[model samples]
Target: MKRLIAYIMLALSLAACKKQNVKDTGPTTVVTPPVTGIIDTSRTSWWQKAKFGMFIHWGVYSVPAGIYNGVDISDPGSGHYGSGEWIMHNLQIPVASYKEFAKQFNPTAYNPEEWVQLAKDAGMKYIVFTAKHHDGFAMYDTKYSDWNVVKATPYGKDVLRPLVDACRKYGLKIGIYYSQANDWINKGAANGGFWDVAQNGSMDDYIDKIAIPQVRELLSNYGDVLEIWWDIPDEMTTARAAKFSPVLALQPRTLTNNRLNQNWTGGDFDTPEQNITASSGGRPWESCMTMNDSWGYTKNDKNFKSSSTIIRNLIKVASLGGNYLLNVGPDANGKIPQPEISILKDLAGWMRINSESIYDTYASPFKFTPWGNATTKLTADGNTNIYLHIFNWPGGEKLHVPGVKNQLLSASMLANGKSVNGINDDTGITLDIPVGPVDNISSVIKMVVKGKLQVEVYEQGPEANGSFILSAAAADLHNPNGWDDIHVENEGNPNLGYWTNPWAYATWKIAVKTPGIYKVQAEIATEAGATVMVASVNGEAVQKTLTSTGGYGSYRLVTLGNLKIANSGSVTFTLAPDPGNWQPVNVRKVILTP
Candidate 1:
């Protein structure tokens, strides 16, 4: 009882820990204000406390994997655009052709208990299965549409029912991801916005007949769903979004994503797909990413992210007050592949040691660090429990924590309960670390400090004239595949997003010492021309087209024009394509010069 009281008190005092002086930037930087009532409101979500979860994108697409009519999907000419899950639309397989997979969709090996047990063993708290993706193939037993699993498949059973039951049996929170729009079953699902099929129907009839009723069935039939993950609200309007409210009224506690309309109209949280979202105004957001390049099974694609990358991504998400919904694409036989299975085992090993740092914690109030990320859970007392997840551990006897004012009570390695000597001085707190990292993945340095945390956020670099060089390393690649050295994009091309996505973006959260219309110049080298690089301060943006540098990797620094800021604060620069289409470019860094 006393502990509960202490926890409440800690929660109340959490806002006081936000450092006013720091330049706010996430591992990948982009601070989007979350919608009201849905994002981090007075009523905290149980889903937020349950930090980690699983995202499964399964359907008839698993049967095709990547090939359709002997056409290689990797080739753009093959009409294969996006992930393996979208193979139906990408290959332009007629509705008649795509329906053939449903007949053969017999997951006789689909063991719900095994899948749930695997998730539990991986230390995942929840599961968000793709009950229905853009393909419009419903995995659940839906009475509204005959295009569902029970009627269409040879297995002739509700695939999702056993999974939901098993989740309940295993004490895991389960949610359903329903694609609100883009029902390829409706001929026009591939194209964005509204498309009418003369023979089949309009999107409106599809929604009224299939979408709304199916949602109602999901909430009513499923026992206590934590989330109703919605996707691709292309052409979704406010009125269309309103139709979902009745469905949500069935399950008031169930959270929805922001993509309910043209903008983030209806959602309990912002969903940053395949990338860590930069936390803003303390919003409740999550990053849904896949293990491999594709969300669903892809036979030819073997570019699976390492176990260490998965662990680090989790830390990065937690550090920014978001959940990590890692994905796995099961095969047509409903078995998770070997590489994905191995990665989950690795995650389980890591979580067993460091889940305390992840689950039930808000973003760290302290400033950012290049080495890694941080997360803080307020203790029963007013003291803050800070978890320093050292990803790029600099080999040194002493680890320096600059500009933090707090009374350090204890310091220990989470992996091993070995206590480390702490030294607090005017230079900030320095911990005496061992000769090597405690764990190769990410070593957690758990520090329990008394009272609220006081952290230094802004670091001023040496200015020459009126310009400052912002290192490429400091800029946050706010995408899912945004790593330190390499740029990662999970979709578009089977290889990555960078090559295929025209709207690829990276951000830099610059702590401007001099607030003015500083010249924004980017040191870049790429093979594309007529490409747009949009530089912006906050949301105010300016664009300029670029010609190719001498060649790929041939370098040149070009001025992207100027951006104006009102006062000395964190100025965000979003480097992305101009507007309509995906443009390609390789960026080193953006420098602000007067």
Candidate 2:
């Protein structure tokens, strides 16, 4: 009986060993990766397909075109005392200024079809026309206000109506930019209106009599508004916004921006003006920037961003999982400036070739590095693809990437459809970029992973050479609060001192979980008497130093070599001041690309 039992136990043990060996030989099972963050995928529904769009800033402001009373009136700096868009109001030019403009605003060559055709040729998928600017003059016909294009102009036409119709006919989505803060016309309505003139009128009465009624007219007149770009409602309170939320019911799916109220009570998305933020995981965001320095038509404003600059900005925004709405200011004749049109066409051409990296894409699992930007998208089968945008290629055939550990399926350039080789290791992935510089603009490399990509970032201190930190102050500067934090001193003020003569100093302690090459960058300003500024790691002086002059400075990227850190390693950063008391320093942002 004992011998029989021993035989049975031996058989059972053999069987278990065989099962374990079989499991080791078979393919490994992969668990489904977690979604990074919840994004209203619906917000991407429209913008993803419509990869590129045009913003037309045409309004009564265009009529003045930065002039008043036969004189070129500039904004506050140029000896004008009003918002550039409010020149007529600041100079109190009265109805005469507008009347004269009306006579010359005939726009005899204005053809809606021609405009739409030009946009289509340029590859714009949508158009956002200014229905009303700060001037309070409506471009569309509205029963609620007599100060509209149909009633106030010699042309006596609803300018926006034909544009909308033409856009729809040409397969373009239509968006409207509405000035919720009325300037000249509806001043008595709701919280003193645009010019902030407090009249003895009830807020509700003004909203009911003018604001809401005009909004209702717009929704009813337009076929279907995809977005409502509201601007400059500084006086609007949360209660006021709640009262106005019902207006959105007229067009339920329409997207709204955060500018309508101080608190952004009913905004569908956060609007970052002229700047893009690092990804908030999966938060929805849009960057609205003007073609020129000014939002409205300014004849003397020659500060237009170049075509390449605009395209780069768009890509940067997209890489951070945000949309870009580039603006254009038309002349008084209702014609887009030739220069602006040229830039848009160039952007459109680029989008046609490389938009796959942008449209329908999400923020990459890897953080943005000094080498360039990065973005990611998911395939239909749930496989994930990452795109690396290299604006300043390292000029080498091979490039190393850290913090990625997934199996790579393929690597290729999205522009030319050329395949590239890559090496995958436990630390990260490395790809062989094209041997030579292909173009002056940025190039994208696509990396397909078997499943979702996972990565975490750690910072090491100055003592641990090559470690970095993105200070709280730098993060706060990019907050939606406002551009008030854009000053030179505020750039890296709270964390790293400005690169000025009087060197202000700050100490940063960073902890790193792994050892790797890390890159550091800071936004610094230069003023008179400013000399070279230095940064040191762990009391060891860094070789790279930045020199500045008296002006708005550019971002200086500092490459700290590979750092070796075990678990719980820490490092510190120190800044040395230049000789001078000049407070001509600012440090806006600091990036630690590990």
Candidate 3:
């Protein structure tokens, strides 16, 4: 998680981060009460069953909305701002000057009950709010530091207390997002992703003086906290991370993520930020993502994801046996952005009709689905309910569900009780699906199975007639949990692609029938400069130089000189970024012909 390389060039003077009116602040003091036991994860089943939650990133940065000194940093491609939450670090606003914004940070419209009710309506079971962000701005009352909402702002009230109370009243689990590392105001850790070369205090001092005390305060103050989400472990050493373990004992069932230290092995869960991990290997994880591109409120940030996108994403995470922590960045007035509110309301409508498809659901029992994500849950009668979330409703009545070998009891549209008939066979079941749009965003079809659900493994696709198309969807992604996997790419297409890292690649398996000198071609889309793709099969390889097809969807055909095939057997094909030409490439389909 070290972003120092990206920000090293943008680092500003340390004096630029201090304010003239800064009051003398004392070092944080902490007293860890005696705790004797390790955290028991028995109660975390509730979290796994919940499937969906809310993430709120609110702080003094919302006041600026990414503007400073008449310059707008929030605008995309501005290159002036990175994360809205880290604008202080990005823009180099001194602590003294940043504190002045506290005078205008009063969120008069803030109502905890309203927030909690909205979450409930959306079918979200939990709320993880920013108790303290990396700017070292505490939203709660902290006795360890005076740089908090209650101590510095005109609001002069603890924001977290009411939120905790309301969540408890509404029967929603609550969690505090504490940036345990990367404190902009703490000594040594304040260097913006890098170690401070001119630091005057030791990291141990910061850990003992601030982090432990603030964490202790949060755990003690919050009622039955469900999680303590720590962000950016760039500065957290193994020993420093151990300090929080004592305080974590206070909340036996409260979970922590794996970011305490970059490579720290101790955490209750994995937190994949902004993008879904391709695989978690059965470990509990959550994908925390922002509705828009920015995590915090930015005035001109209008890249809000559609309600349909949000619903599908939630289903995507839930179907993968992970939770979806969708984010909402409220404006400075304490009101959730109207776009975000409308999106939540729209999601509420979908949840009303399909919550059962999500809650307590297991991963799909099949290898893959062309329509969309699938979920399953056990019924009282010992039946397994398979929920097929149809993103692209197959036009025909026969919806092919491949590789399912379970006894089917019944199939019906979840939105309504309408029955759906299907033919069950060895390859899988093919349902005689009902016509018409069941739901605009996503339609859920519930299929009941007789016994323990099981699915056939994926077999190598046939290369009939001496030709085969290896789709990006079936490619072996280089970065398992990155944006390059099963998500929408530019050009409004779903494929394996990324515009940033040039070295990213995807491999595919092929059936080498009638192996010989086969003509190989690639259908690609790009939004960047010219690049080359090295297509290697077995031991033979060829490079194809490519030009941008304009956008991510504007794909063009490029031929890689014929590759020699040895014998007729299973073969491996790898498409990788041609070294030295670090440009973006999106390969949708790799075609091999004899």
Candidate 4:
């Protein structure tokens, strides 16, 4: 629901982003600059280890089930297009009309134990359920408002307490998803509405009388809340955000996400929606993705992601040291979509065999791999365990791994525990790949390394076509003076630019097989006169004087003289300015073709 709103806001702000450096204006509100807070590792250790969880966006939105007044929620002809949860805002449904759906919101078939069991069987470490959403409808029995399930709905019961109990009974942690702002039904609350006169009330009054008290009720009543999932801080200022901090302080160990208020700096983790965002150094993060196109249950939404994609996404997130909070939206009758259940069953089967590679794993040591991703962990015996999640099994007998400097102790298939052979060299190691993948979806190859994990930077070998591409994005920059301007950038494209320092250089480790004469071409852009650079390999060198290719951003591939290689082995390749006659140049990549 918040994800859909975010995309719309991004589209509307694209022009401003192109004109100047623009920051994210979250849901019609200005986001203050981020504040840094001391991160307590002790408070986050359990969450970091729990790399996967379940997200439930169940709400009264399920009552409409993506249809309102005989029109589809996303019907283009009706001029409405958004997620099921945003039906009220997108279709401009009045608060009075929207409240009528609450009368029909019944979940008699909702079995808390069944939901918890499904999550546990799917190998999820925790479950985060929607307690309240943007429509100002609470799934729980909040004393502050009659716009709650217990007082308004036919089912007339609190949904959260039983879910929490079930999670505890099944030894799984539970969290609550609360929308602290943009309550459409509450008078004076900030909301996306012009027609609903009932929504005209003081924002501060809504926060004090409704949002804050409800938050306090949720945190205090729910025993041992694992996380506090706040969404869409539309008009929540820092002062308003601070009101909930004391309520959260009651449960000191409960984790909170960044969306409570973008200005608030005391979040335990970042919540990146619908995408596997890159790791922010070692900061805790989670990607909340849906099983299909919608976060809330849409009866007509059948755009379900494949089981393979879901599995690989989980692996990809774990490899990057983040959690995957996969979502499932239950219908009004409390039945999960059939396709979602089937996907969960598939995940259950896969996790039953390959979960050891995921749990408590650190980020990959290598920068990138052709086949798939990797995760590592330090063993109790002082060794390192590298779990290779292979999406594309190699056709040849050998599966190459670059940049690794550790000695391989043992290799085995995690699925069946069968021994695999590994051959080591200075460049990296190669695993004797099996005839076929043990599991076709994604095979986990576990390799134990001796001592601490050591990986050489910017090391690579030839692709299947026997061509070596030393890209500037992967180059190891050497700045002896510590103020060298030479660095990789993406101005027009990804290239090494701002080469003002003559002493600084870039290098790559290449493992050459089937040694022979290879054609070398460099993609460089420069306006300086007759810039000379020395490209060197094991005792052999090529000194080339390059001509201008129009401008610094206008790149052209110019052929550089090739040198002979005496042997087929790993060697260092260096590109440095010719000391006496050096000029600035932007380098994209150097290609060696045999």
The best candidate by lDDT is 4
1-594, model 2: which lDDT tens digit per residue? 233223333433442232111010112222232232225456646764454567777776777788776566654465664335666666655454454565556565678887787777666678888887766678888887777778877778888888999999999889888877545555453233233333334655666677777778778789898888887676677776676677879988787876788655346666656655432324455677788777777887777877777777777767655677777777777777888878867866776777778776765444335466677778888788888877778867887665565788999888887998998864467888877645457788888988666543323233344334455332211122331123112211332332222423433335554455455555555553424444444323433344453465444444433332323454434433332324444554455556
Clashing pairs in 3: 17-94, 17-95, 18-94, 19-96
**Candidate 3, which segments miss by more than 4 Å at Cα?**
1-43, 193-201, 264-266, 476-491, 499-505, 509-513, 525-556, 560-584
Clashing pairs in 1: 22-457, 275-480, 489-497, 502-582, 502-583
Over 4 Å off in model 2, which ranges? 1-38, 41-44, 48-51, 70-77, 81-84, 90-92, 121-123, 189-204, 278-282, 458-509, 512-567, 570-585, 588-594
Residue-pair clashes per prediction, in order, are 5, 17, 4, 2
Q: Sort every candidate by TM-score, greatest first.
A: 3, 1, 2, 4
Q: What TM-score does prediction 3 earn?
A: 0.84
lDDT of 4: 0.78
Q: Quote the positional error of residue 264 for candidate 2 in Å.
A: 3.5
Tens digits of per-residue lDDT for model 4 on 421-440? 99888567889989899888
Q: What is the C-alpha lDDT profile of model 1 across 496-528, one tens digit per residue?
A: 124334433555445566677778888776677
Q: For each candidate, what is the lDDT?
A: 0.72, 0.61, 0.73, 0.78
